[model samples]
Target: MRLRILSADERLQEAQGKTTMALFGPSGAGKTTLLKTLPTEETVCLDLEAGLKSVQDWRGDSLPIRRFADAVDIACLIGGANPAAQPDEHFSEAHHAHLRAQHPELAARLDAKRIVFVDSITDLTRQAMAWAKTRPEALSERTGKPDTRGAYGLLAREVIGLLKHLQHAPGRTVIFVGILEKVVDDMNRVSWQPQMEGGKAARELPGIVDQVLTLSLFRQDTDQDGAVSWQHDAEKGHARRLVCQSGNPWGLPAKDRSGKLALTEPADLGALLTKINQTLKG
Candidate 1:
């Protein structure tokens, strides 16, 4: 085997091009409407939740994801194949070729776009979980009784693997949208997390994507010193804010691995992506 080394300039160029972001927020936060902010010509939305009803006036292309196979096959078509995957894996080189040969038009639709938006990974995970329940892992080998643990285990691997494959798609920017759920523990402590079928997905997703952002409402306020700050208040007049990094006062689930974003940005996905790419280039 021959080994090739990348120069420092080459490495920097490779790192600067595209972004993979996970955007989550509560229902009715206009998460779906944000798709309209993206450039219609270069963007394609994978409407997994059929949530495009809110953005009907927006002019852009969309693909519906109704089944588990649709999610996996579309991902493979967009991201191409994973040479490292086994032959049996859906993202394997062999499977990718088969899909391209069979559905050339479907492949072309995604290939023409640079941005791939997966609307609501929560529904995608539900689809995966539903499929997992029918697999051998969901049944006990000895008693043949239903095994929820096995199903959940399989579900985690499938969801995470799909996410990682999409993350590595060359020259493509991918955004995974998810519902953010508010959870109160038995001790009465409240926390917010990405709403997915299993706990593992929420924990693993922040690590997989380049950015984790939460979109929500915040009241514009002024302190005694007349310094402006945004606070989460129900009674005050509120506007949408995108929490881009962690340790924010709202305690939202946010992370910016690129270290290029401000703690808060305007709730515009297109502007945010442009800012990130610009910073990356600099």
Candidate 2:
């Protein structure tokens, strides 16, 4: 079969495309609440954490992700199929075709939305780990003992595959929200990481997405505390800010692969999307 080459116009048209972002922050930092800032008509939340109570008042459509299979099915439906995957792979062409045929309505619903918001990847990792443990690879053949390490390996592949599939979805903006964890080393050195069952997925997530945003409350001072307060305290300065670019003084985990965002931006997601789109056009 002869390979079809993309013309200059096709390449340039592809360059002006959608974005895939991963938003991370400590719990109670209003990461989920930021969904309210997105256009309700064009956005659909994949509620994996069951933590949409914060945005209960927001009138937007949401699909609850009850299990790991649900996540895989939804991702395949939204992103189509993985052409490079093996025939038997979960997100392979055959599997995706089966899913689309089985659930046409679900696919149609998701097709109408431009933005796919996954509530929390932290929960997705946990569920994936659980599902991985049930697989045959998680057990020692001779000893019949549970292999924790094997399960984690499978969990990482599952999570990364789902994320990459959605990241490549055409004409759609995919946003994955996760928990930011504070870790202390043996020497008392502290570092921030995304909460995941396996280290590999957490470490490689920043590379898989276009933007890595850290949503947190910033104060005038350099003091860092893990707490969320809505009321403004005159004595204690605290305001929610979205850290957009990397290498900031705050040491937050953030990056803009498009090279279009400022060091810091407002917490409003709608405005942020507009800014990113405008930069893409420019």
lDDT of 2: 0.86
**Residue-wise C-alpha lDDT for candidate 1, range 110-181, written one tens digit per residue:** 888988889989999999999999999999999999899999999999999999989999888899999998
TM-score of 2: 0.90
TM-scores of the models, in the order given: 0.95, 0.90
Off by over 4 Å in 2: 1-4, 7-9, 15-17, 220-237
Error of 1 at 71 (Å): 0.6
Worst 10 residues of 2 by lDDT: 228-237
146-253 per-residue lDDT for model 2 (tens digits):
999889999988899899999889888999999988788999986778888899999999999999998877664433685532332223437887888888766679
lDDT, candidate 1, equals: 0.88
Q: What is the C-alpha lDDT of each candidate?
A: 0.88, 0.86
lDDT of 2 at 234: 20
Among the numbered candidates, top TM-score falls to 1
- List the RMSD of every prediction in angstroms: 1.6, 4.7
